[model samples]
Target chain A: MDLVERIRSGNKRTLSKLITEVEYDTETGREALRELYKYTGNAHVVGITGSPGVGKSTLVARIVKELRKREISVGVVAVDPSSPFTGGAILGDRIRMQELACDPEVFIRSVSSSAGTVGRTTKNIIRVLDAAGKDVIVIETIGAGQVDLDVLNVADTKVIVLMPESGDEIQMIKAGLLEIGDVYVINKADLENAARTKSQLSLAIKERDGWIPEIVMTIATSGEGVEKLVDAIFAHKKHLEDSSNLRKGRLEAVKSEVVEILVEKLKMRFYEKFSNARYSDIFEQVLDKELDPFTAAELIEKEEGL
Target chain B: MKKGKNIRVLIAKPGLDGHDRGAKVLARACRDAGMEVIYTGIRQSPEQIVETALQEDVDVIGLSILSGAHMSIIPRILELLNESGIGDIPVIVGGIIPPDDVEELKRRGVKAIFGPGSSVNEIVEFIKSIT
Candidate 1:
């Protein structure tokens, strides 16, 4: 059978291969996705993101363990940042979730965020998991500060994991995480000042648009309060479904995906047009101080009939 | 396409060995050499190794076995990789393999073996050359 057929039949190997294809943006991967796109939209996509060392990976591993107890088939997309100098990543998230590695019902894949847009690759991988019949798909983003709101566009439920010692509540608010988090978590709650941080987060989360985001405190290492966090996630899922918010979220996701694809296509077209001898000639002219970038761009536009 | 895309390698330790200093060092070396390294932690089963390798879609699988179980574990991994239809992907073994076991491992589809004090640069270069 072909890749699409194998993926639809719940083949983990094919699902993985297709995910790699999409992650690398290969032609075969694109064709596979085009064929399998129609099989998507069934799984609930959840994005778990937070600052580094807040125990995001540990929390996700605990959540996946709890999810399995409820007989949920999960697909985890763990994203790790690539080294800027080396283009290499440690991808240590799977180590935390190693218990789930041998579980047939649980599929975990680690991806490097260096593959262009983390959000786009994440969404595409979620689609592959959905096509493979996972009931819940979790996207764990690179915990690199506050620039990771891209997860907001790819998940049905956006969860931001934070710690009690994550610093001043005002800083969290300023980071704009308060606005995007559908469910907030105070992980490492065993640390001192847990209650104080919870209260501060509670005050910061005031009711928004009729949906109040719940703050759940968790000691991920011991799996403390993970059950309540799971409950909050289910409650949020129910709220989205009951209030028809799911439809709105799906529409936004589709819109963002379209924009991402369009931007990538335009970039590819621009590179294809300029990656020849003409590009080198322009570079040499710029290096010799014979042409400014702006003038060179205008000349190229005119010459290319743009 | 970019000149050289990221080379993904899965550094897995199978069996009950907890000695990961060598594995960690190799992972860092590969990362420094500009390859994505996915460390599977310690004491992983062959099933877990093969499954993780397939899911990660790694270009190379580096097995770190400090115990004297390379004879048993290496073949299991190779068999599983072949069964999974991904045997073409190179499998490199590291850690205490007897010199007598080297030819046998290579014959059983083990690509390369890096023993004690083996150069990390050599491992990186081998991966680059093979993949």
Candidate 2:
């Protein structure tokens, strides 16, 4: 059977192989993804982002458990940083999720942040899992920074997890993180100033599209308040459902995905075309200031008739 | 065979061994060598290790055990991998296996074994050569 059919038939091994194909960006992977694209849009993608050591993975593990209790099948994509120098990643998020391993209802894949994004290929990975028949897919970003809001484009529910007494609440308000989160979680609530952090978040969070973001406290290690966090996620999902926001968001995501693919292809093509020794004269021209970068680029474009 | 393909390896600690320092160092070394290493942390069961390897579709599986349980745990891991139909993914064992057991492990389908005093370069070179 073909990969798409095998994935549809719930063959875990085939599903995994396809994911690897897609992760590695192979042509076969692209073909399989195109075939499986029609089967997507069924899974609810929940993106969890936070700084390192904020219990994002622990919270994700708890959320997956809560989801399973409700009879929902889950797929988790846990992203960890690849070394800038070595292009290697530890991907230790599964360490906190050992209990979920034996559960056939859950499928977890660890991804390396290879292309510099928090969750590179995350949108495509979500589609693969969605096609494989997961009910909900969770994307755990690699300890996001203020501007690492790529999750905003893929996740239906954007959850920004933070810890108490970390003073990140103030930092979040000034950045794109505040604008993207559909739900806010102050995990490690047992730490001091939990209420203060929550109140700070509440005060800064404004209503968007008639849906007010909810801040739920969670102690993810003990699974405390995770159920409430899951409820908040569902509530946000429902809010998107009752409104036209879900369709609109999906449309926007689709547009962004297409544009990103186009840009990436153009970049690769540009490098491939210009890296040859034949382009040395063009480089010399630029180095000698015979032409400005913009005009030189135009010349290259015109020479290629692009 | 794609240009962008990366060798994905699952670095697991089987049984109750908590001495993951070697595993972690090797994971870093693998990454530094431009491979994606999935470290499942310490105290993982054989079932958990197999499941992770399958799900991740890793090209290699590196087992790090210090509890002197490689004899018992490694076989169960191999058995589970075969049952899962991913037995072809090479299994490389590290961490305190005596030289006598090395031959036995290789006979049992362990691709390679790295004991103490083994350089990171040697291990990395071995993985790159194989995968």
Candidate 3:
């Protein structure tokens, strides 16, 4: 059988293979997704994002365990940063989630954000998991860059995880994280100043028009206060379902996906049409101050009929 | 084989082994060689390794087992890879392996064996050649 059939039949290997194809952005992968798109739109996409060393992975493991207790199948896409110099990544999230390795109901995959546009490859991987019949699909991004916030577009429920002593209140606000979070989690709450951090976060977060973002304190190591966080997630899910918010979120996600694909295709077409020699000539003119970049770009667009 | 494409490699430590210094070093070596490396941490099961390899669509599977469980672990991974129809993906073994078991592992479809003192350059070159 083809990859789509194998994935629909619950073949974890084929599911993984198809995800790899999508991650690499191959034609075969695109064709496979085209065939498997019909099986999607069933899984609840959750985005768990936080800064480095904030125990996002540990929290994810706890959430997966709690989700498994409910007999809900889960698929995790742990995104790790790739070295700009080497294009390599050490995907260590699986270390914290090793307990789920043997659990057939849980499928965990690690992806490198260096593959392409940030969160673009991850969104595609989530689609594969969704097509594979997962009840809940969680995407854990490398919460290091501003680009990581792009995950908000793909996840229906955006869970922004923070530690008590993260000490980046101003940085979080600047990163636009305060605007994207649907649920705020103060993880590693057992640390010092946990309450202070929680209060500060609450003060920083402005109330939404309809949904007030719930802040849950969690000690992921010992699984303390995790159930409440899960409850908050379920509550958000229920809220989305109760309102037309779920449909609206889906429409927004589709729009983002379409725009991303279009931009990528346009970039490829632009590069293909303009050779390096032409680019070098343009750069030379810019370097010699013969033509400004804006004028050069306009000239190229007019000449190429782009 | 596009220009400047990364050759993704999954450097995994399967079985009940906790010695990961060698795995981490090798993972870095592969990374420094300009290949995308996914290190699976330590004490991973064969099922997890195979699943990760399939998911990563890695060009190679590097097993770092110092627990002397290579006899039991490597074969299980090979079997799983074949069962999953990804047997064509080469499997390379590293770490402390007795001289007697090296030939046996090779016969069992291990692409290459790197014992103690093996240079990282050699391993990276071998992977590049095969891939």
Candidate 4:
């Protein structure tokens, strides 16, 4: 059967297998994506990111619950960092976002960034999940300062989750996080200085160059102000729909993702085709000043031509 | 796509949840199915899961959790995985959980759930039936 029909039919195994092929970037993988790409563009992309201890996970759980209550189909991509030494990443998302795992409408996946940067990992997976009939796809990025920009590249609405106890609001501007937020969430709002943090964020948002981003205060634990937060996001999504410019921004983001994916696939194909002991020996000879990269490429091409 | 050798399973723990005994058990089950298993240490963020899965290019990401924080962490991991671009990783959940919450998890995005006292053989067979 054709790939598009299977995807539209909601065959879980077929969806799973197609994603695997694309993950490997094989010949069929490209074909599968080409076939599946037309079926995309349906799911709303939501980005959830913050510092290490800001309770971002808890907030995500709340968001998922809220979305599910509306009977909206959801897809989630939980991004985790990797071990530098072993090149391994520990993936554990189900423990926290357990409520929706068994739901027929939701498709949750965990990705380890231990293999590559957020720039590389975020692009293709969005397509994979989007094609799987999700009404919404949530992207939870590794919140380490500026690398957070990677999330902005993919999310239709970027929600920057934050805390007051984390530090002065000026630090976020310094880190450049202030400019990227469509929604500024001051989570842990039940804390002692939660209100103060909200004002601080308000001040920071006021100073921003573009439209004044909306800031919502929430205690993610007790579910305080979560509805407003959700409403704020929906409002912003509607605003995007109303404004042609925001839609343009979304298209630009998709175009950029395509470039990134192509570059990554090209690099991977080259390494997979030429990265071996034989290629290493050629490199070693080049290291001795016997041959340059240009000469090595020539020789490798010549060998392949034979 | 074979009975075993073609698949590699990664059972990971994202976030600050340190309970890994259940994760270890699932890892063992995947291994027993003749699939290669990669286990990461505890307290993994969602980004780590996406990067590792892409690098290793595994078939499954089995998350083990005992902490009652499943709501937040699972969605976080799912969002990031979608962002990273590899989707063949059919995620399965195993650990401490209540009954009603199971349906909610399915609605949010988990492909399968392995509760306490579930047979390892049941897991193996379920996996076989999927891919």
Residue range A119-208, candidate 2, lDDT tens digits: 446778888899989999998987755224765457899998888877765574785677778999999999988998888888888999
Candidate 1 iRMSD in angstroms: 1.5
Off by over 4 Å in 2: A117-120, A145-147, A168-172, A265-286, A295-306, B1-3
lDDT of 1 by residue, A1-306 (tens): 978778888787778778877877788888888988899998988889888889989999999999999999999999888877778889989999888888989999998777456677777888899999999999898876433677556888889898886879667567477777889999988899999988888888767656899999999999999999999999999998899888987887688678967887888988887776667898789889999989988988888787
Q: What are the runs in model 4 whose C-alpha is more than 4 Å off?
A: A145-147, A206-210, A261-306, B1-131
For candidate 4, what is the DockQ?
0.07
**lDDT over C-alpha atoms for residue B19 of model 3:** 89
Best by TM-score: 2
How big is the positional error of residue A165 in model 3, measured in Å on the Cα after superposition? 1.7
Q: Interface Cα RMSD for candidate 4? A: 9.7
> Sort by DockQ, best first: what order?
2, 1, 3, 4
lDDT (10s digit) by residue, model 1, range B1-131: 43366888999899998999999999999988889999889999999999898888889999999889888888999999999888989999999999999999999989999998899899999999999
Q: In model 1, where do residues sit more than 4 Å from their true spots? A: A145-147, A267-306, B1-3
Which CAPRI level is candidate 3? Answer: medium
What's the true lDDT of residue B6 in model 2? Answer: 76
Per candidate, chain B TM-score? 0.96, 0.95, 0.96, 0.87
Model 1 chain B weakest 10-residue run by lDDT: B1-10
Q: Is candidate 1 or candidate 4 better by TM-score?
A: 1
